[model samples]
Target: MKSVILSSVLPLATVITAVVGIAGAASAAEPDKQFFQSAEGKWIGPGEIVAGKYKGTKFNCSFTGSTPDGKVGMSLDGGCRVGMFTQQMSAKIERKGREGYKGSFMGGATGSGLDIIGGNVVDARKVVFTINRNQLRGVMQARIPDDNSMTVTIAVRVDDQLVPVIGMSLKRVDAVEVGSIAPN
Candidate 1:
């Protein structure tokens, strides 16, 4: 019985393994804070909206990533440009309490953007955040494929599945690495 219960909870547990909390046993083996620190520096790259009505829209972006001193989170601030139009891009995620992560993007769900209500560090190379606005819910993943590149994808819940809506690929323009990345 215990085995069956543990099996059923493992999936959710995998993601909620204390990304919202103080650094604990769940993340002891993973350098969650180091991951954020390593992600610092300026990034530049291109991306496309691969799905939804905005599909095929292409844009370029530049951002600066930083981690608060003595903290286990990161803040990404920058903007994207589509033709002559420019959109400011910003996100901040910090570990809180003894549970999971919390932060915002563009702005909070109350302003013009979505709220990052919860999240977890999946591994050394990937972290997943849950975003919500009104009735629309989504998941954002930031994956660092190498020291010089990061990729971000936002997928919204469609019916019973999550569909990719926005993708960003960024390269470390200020660091010494040949790579590309994405934004939320």
Candidate 2:
């Protein structure tokens, strides 16, 4: 009689603990979804590649697209010229899980594409991602300083060391609605 009672209570306690754990995990993911939802709309402004092979070259980047809560979709495009060399990239990012992304980046017009994986949101205002292929590894970070500005940094792994390669800043561009405009 004593052994049967003890066994019955142990299983009931274990089931209760598991249910609570699942509820806690579901609640924890709500904040991440809210964080991504806040960064909606288009951000357009000027920036520069302050490191790597393109240091001191000024350029403009435009970021457009908004991810609905619990979804992911964003793109980035930057172009600039230094002497006879031109640099540019076009990439699309999609949300992964509760706080991560995955995308592909195409460097320049005729360049081979790189795979973007392991993207994560470190906080409410920062997003990071990694790219790896063969012997090359790279990390990219996008941070928001305020409601109107963003900063991007890119780094690559070389000789077992991670080195800064690019830095960029952009400002949020508000969209204009047709119905909101009045005849001048």
Candidate 3:
């Protein structure tokens, strides 16, 4: 009886292990995966006012470090003029999502505590975010096809239409490789 019992238990354990392994692999390959696995890095670019009333001016922007909780944070620094006045400002980007993200910005010349809403499109080699209504959009596309460098683009609305405002090229300074360790 002991021998027979041992034989049955061993086969059951093998079947269980195989099932678990298959489930783990399936989860890892699932589509519609949110949050990027390669977005943890530093990105710098220049922004321009291409639309609306302010159509010409350059601003510097940087995205540094991604939160462990799946949020990308960034900062913007630059100056521009609006109708006989020059101003300098700083802004921060908090989070990005399918519908959009929420963040706040401030400036020394006119507007302070301004809110930003945008949505991001992320793939293996590119990330793009669009802020509607404000007519502003940001894009980060790979430069060397498979390398770590990327080209960034910013577009804004002018006269109720969308137009490219600024463009910059950036390189990824760091990234974290992610993988599944267990079955979901």
lDDT values, one for every candidate: 0.60, 0.46, 0.34
- 1-184, model 3: which lDDT tens digit per residue? 2222112211111111111111111243221122233333444444444443444544444444233333344444333333454444444444443344344444211232234454333444444443322222332222223334455444444466545544444444444432421111
> Which pairs of residues clash in candidate 3, taking residues 3 or more apart in a chain or in different chains?
51-157, 51-158, 52-157, 52-158, 100-118
Stretch of 10 with least lDDT, candidate 2: 15-24
Candidate 3 ranges beyond 4 A from true positions: 1-35, 44-63, 70-99, 105-114, 132-147, 174-184
Clashes of each: 12, 0, 5
Q: After superposition, how far is residue 149 of candidate 3 from its true place, in Å?
A: 1.2
Best by TM-score: 1
RMSD of each: 10.6, 18.5, 21.6
Better of 2 and 3 by lDDT: 2
For residue 137, model 2's alpha carbon misses the true position, in angstroms, by: 1.2
For model 1, residues 1-184, the per-residue Cα lDDT tens digits are 2221112111121122112222223356256754565567777788776775556877787777766665676677777667997766676677775656787665566765667788777777677888776777778777777777777776778899998766777667773431233332
